[model samples]
Target: MTRRTENLAGRALMAAFCLAVLVPFAGIVLAALHPPGSVVPGLSWPQHPTLESFTRAWSDAGFGGLLRNSAVIALGVVPLALVCASLAGYAFATMTFRGRKVLFGFLMLGLALPYEAAVVPLYYDLRAIGLTDTPLALILALTGLFMPFGAFWMREQFLALPKEMTEAASIDGAGSWTVLWRVLLPCSRPALITLGLLYFLWAWNQFLLSLILIQNPAGRTAPAGLGFFVGAHNIDVPLLSAATLIVIGPVVAVYLFFQRHFIAGMLAGAVKG
Candidate 1:
């Protein structure tokens, strides 16, 4: 077959795959707008569209409070995670210290540890400390949970930088913190933003953690809020669909806004020699 034919076939396959993934979501959107008690026909638009479901779902599920809590937790976790990860990663990548390799190896173990394994222990620990059912618990847990990957990502970014940059800064009397904050960090914007966005997404969508850690429904994140919504509206497909869409809207908006930078950041380390 000619190259043109092969390219067309590949394109067709990709389009089909995308459609397959999107078709159900499209149905959900239509179903959300469908009249109460009406059956949603497969792959068809709503016959009697109404805005009531969105409003009803939003108020009844307490999404406003959920969104607020999720945002606060994400905002709390992302910066702390990024800063700690970046600093630790820089040290691991550049500095020689006693037990550095061992410490880093321990952090790396976090990457392989399942959240389920840690949740029970974390719950009891936090409860003992009187932090369970609080936003702080989620923030701290997520930051710790994210540390392994975050540190590794930043370490890769730091390692990719030329050694001469650090040498030059040192020769000019720049200290370690200054070199990191003023010089290296400015150049690491893409990687930093990518890391921060990833952390934000993880913290926002965190379900099991939010569900198990916070007993107060008001402190739950969107995904966790949707869990309650699911139980309350189990048989009401339209309401359930509306709640699901509401929960996903913020994540979708965030991706759309930072798509270009996100793409670049993801590919930044791919070509390193």
Candidate 2:
């Protein structure tokens, strides 16, 4: 095929994919706009669109508390995971240590372990320590769960940097900490931002961990809270859709805000790899 024909075909394919995703989302939005207690048939537009469902769902679901808990867990997990990942990545990439390969392989095993398989034992373990039903439980669990991917991501990023950067910093009286903080981190901003965003997204959307660990209704994350909300109002499509939008709003906002950086980081990794 000619280049122009290939370009048109690709554009048409992309448009189709976009429509596939957007149509359902549009249906949800339209459903949420219908008057409360009224049945929405498929993707039809409401004659009287109202924000009442959004307000009602917000109040009923206690989204304020749920979102706050999610934020707290995400805030806690992101920093702890980032620090550990960065340190581990640096050590694995730049420093020599005994059992390094063995340890890394062991750590990578976490990537293979399904979250569903581990969550049951993890809940029991946390309950044994009386940490269940607390924000700290989710925070710690998510941090540990995220480490393998975070470490691997940062390791690849650090490895992609020229060795001379570290050597040059060392010759200038820079220690390991200094080299990492001053020289490497400045250059790895894209990768770090990308990894942090991923951590935030995972921590925010974490339902199973929050549900299994946090028995207290007040301490549940947004997604976990949404699950119960769904149970209570399964037939209320408008209310459920509004709550769903609320739960996903922050994630969408964060991604839109950092969209450029996220894309850049992915492209950088692709080129490096």
Candidate 3:
């Protein structure tokens, strides 16, 4: 086959893959729109579709408080993670220092270790410090947990930059901090935004950490709160579906808004790193 034919075939396959993924989600939307307590076949559009299920789910599930708590955690995590990760990543990628490789190896070890494996020890440690059940605990724990990936991502972005750029900036009397903030970071927008959005989604949807770390129901994230909501309303499909959408809406919206940047960042990181 010609190269043109092969390219067309690849595009067709990708379209089919996207359709396969979206069909199930479309069904969930339809399920949420169906009348409460009514059985609807898979992917069937409801004759009397209404958004009443959304309202009911939002109010009944205490999603207002849950959402607030999630927002707090995400807001705390994203900026802190971004700043720390970018700095660390830039150091690892650009600077030569004693024990740099050893330190980076330790950071990479975090990527290998499952967060679940350390949860028990973390619990006891936090309990000892009297940090249990506080938003601070969640923020600190998640920031640590997300550090490995965030640092690695920013490191890759920095590595992809031309060495001459930094050299020229230095010759022009710009310090490392000035070069990073004024020169490199402005150009690293795609990677930065991608990292921030990923952190937001992970922090928002965090279930086990939210469930175990926060003793108060109001401090739980949406996914963790949805676990409790499911226990009581699992049989109510419409309500469950609506709650799922509510829990996922912000993540989906953020992804849609940054779709192009996210794709570009991922591809750039993969190719250049």
Query: What is the clash count for each candidate, in the order shown?
Result: 0, 0, 0
Q: How big is the positional error of residue 122 in model 2, measured in Å on the Cα after superposition?
A: 1.5
lDDT of candidate 1 at residue 10, scale 0 to 100: 100
Point out the worst 10-residue segment of candidate 1 by lDDT. Answer: 35-44
The ten-residue window of minimal lDDT in model 2 covers: 34-43
Candidate 3 lDDT by residue in tens digits, 173-272: 9998998999899989989988998999889888888889897876788899899999989888998999999999988988999999999888878877
Clash pairs, candidate 1, are: none
Could you tell me the lDDT of residue 219 within candidate 1?
72
Q: Candidate 2: global Cα-lDDT? A: 0.93
The better-scoring model by lDDT among 2 and 3 is 2
Each prediction's whole-model lDDT (CA): 0.89, 0.93, 0.90
- Return the top candidate by lDDT: 2
Which regions in candidate 1 have their CA more than 4 angstroms from the true location?
Answer: 1-6
Candidate 3 lDDT score at position 157: 90
The candidate maximizing TM-score is 2
Better of 1 and 3 by TM-score: 3
Worst 10 residues of 3 by lDDT: 34-43
lDDT of 2 by residue, 1-273 (tens): 999999999999999999999999999999999977889989899999999999999999999999999999999999999999999999999998899999999999989989799998999999999999998898899989998999999999999999999999999999999999999889999999999999999999988889899989889899999999999999999999999999999999999999999999999999986
Supply the global lDDT for candidate 1: 0.89
